[model samples]
Target: MLQRSFYERPVIQVARELIGCYLVREIDGETLVGKIVETEAYAGPLDRAAHSYSNRPTERTKAMFQEAGHAYIYEMHTHALLNVVTGRVGQPHGVLIRAVEPIAGLEVMKQNRATVKRQIDWTNGPGKLTKAFHITKALYAHPLNERPLYIEEGEKGVKIARSPRVGIANSGRAADYPWRFFERGNPYVSTFRK
Candidate 1:
């Protein structure tokens, strides 16, 4: 298991490498584990799609400037989604964890989900994974290589594919950067767009 270091590498590399890792979240005496299968990269300052582009920092985006491998969690509507801020200090870039394949604590995930019709449906989306894992603002900027909430290395023998980011209709050329990575034909992938 390759435990991630907060300063191990650049955001792009981290984004590329994260495709096969596992995201584990422990909460309320239960552990929810998932195999990471999808990610999207956001580069620093110059990347228009990045939150820290142009170095314009805000309270919400402040955590993104933290060292690499730190979780940058935030709320989207009523859902909290988890992201990993990449790049070194003073550089605000990140990779959004788009989806994961549930591995452990699935019963907890079934309970967290709105409608767990099947095992795969338990953690098929970013927001759904957050609910299953109990990820929230409390985990914002938390280091990814540390205890309680750390990334665990999983089956590391799959090929990854880079594609244009989903749901960023207005990012212009940045939307076409092919930074989104995912495992081909993974059932846990979030395929819906809205």
Candidate 2:
């Protein structure tokens, strides 16, 4: 598989490229893989919904500046979510990997997920994906070029649909931007309808 070009484009572009990529994680000598199916692009300092809006460079958001193709993991209300830092070094922008469809090590995912049905629960949310994959703060700023954290081309990428992202009612017009992309009818997608 071709390694993604970290400097190819902005967060929106990167977000589109990210669809159908495989997010690989290694836990306890076992490898878990999931196909990227959903994503949301948060672009520029003017993007009010972005973590680094207005170029606010706090500790939690500093990862947004460490070039693209790096993991930006953060906690939200005691839940860990993952984002891919994108754009150039000085540009504070990223694409939040909202959800994924587990493809490998599903038994591990089931064990991590407990009894939440075989579908609709494996990796449909940011926090859920982390829980299912055993991802945490330890993976923060982890280089995607290394093992246990790299993304690869999935088995025949799917066509992505663009729509406004879920939640973010405080971002004004930015919240309405159709930057979210997802596979059609994929059970692992964040939501079925736009």
Candidate 3:
């Protein structure tokens, strides 16, 4: 599992570095592992796309304010999305795991995402990945280095790629910021390069 120090850096840095790392989760005594492929950065209050922009305190964002390496989970469109808390406490920096490539426990992952017909579709997006791993709000604020859910180190030498974030058109220039990171040529990356 990755140590807390790995997530203590800036949110953008953590998001970029997460590429090729393994995201591990345990459900019903079965282990599920996926290689982190895509990520989007939401840096503190200054970044308008971030939930903590303007320092507007709210319960939904509470997990995002935790110290580095915590899980910040929320539900959207009835699908649970997972974000990794980064930076120091009160910073509210987060790295959204947009997509992952299945690494192990294929049977369990397929069962968890029973509705997905294609294997690649099972975890090609944030919501899809959470479902494939059975992740939910129950893991909110949980440490990323602990059991049930954690990140493992991956092999090096993978090429990293970045692009403007997706689905945030209303955030002005924030939408144009190249805050999304992914492994170059990785098929599991969400919203493939144009």
TM-scores of the models, in the order given? 0.91, 0.93, 0.97
lDDT of 1: 0.80
Task: Spell out the clash pairs found in candidate 1.
Answer: none
Candidate 2 lands at a TM-score of: 0.93
Predict model 3's lDDT versus the native: 0.91
Error of 2 at 8 (Å): 4.1
Candidate 3 weakest ten by summed lDDT: 185-194
- Candidate 3 residue-wise lDDT, 1-194, digit = tens: 99999999988899999998999998788899999999999987978888888675589998887789999998999899999999998889999999999989899999988878999999999999999999999898999999989999996988998899878857878888899999999889886452
Please give the ranking of all candidate structures by lDDT, highest first, separated by commas: 3, 2, 1
* Per-residue alpha-carbon lDDT of candidate 2 for residues 115-153, written as tens digits (9 for 90 to 100): 677656879988899899888998898877687777876
C-alpha RMSD for every candidate: 1.9, 1.8, 1.3
User: For this target, which candidate reaches the highest TM-score against the unseen true structure?
Assistant: 3
Candidate number with the higher TM-score (2 or 3) = 3
The lDDT, on a scale of 0 to 1, for candidate 2 is: 0.83
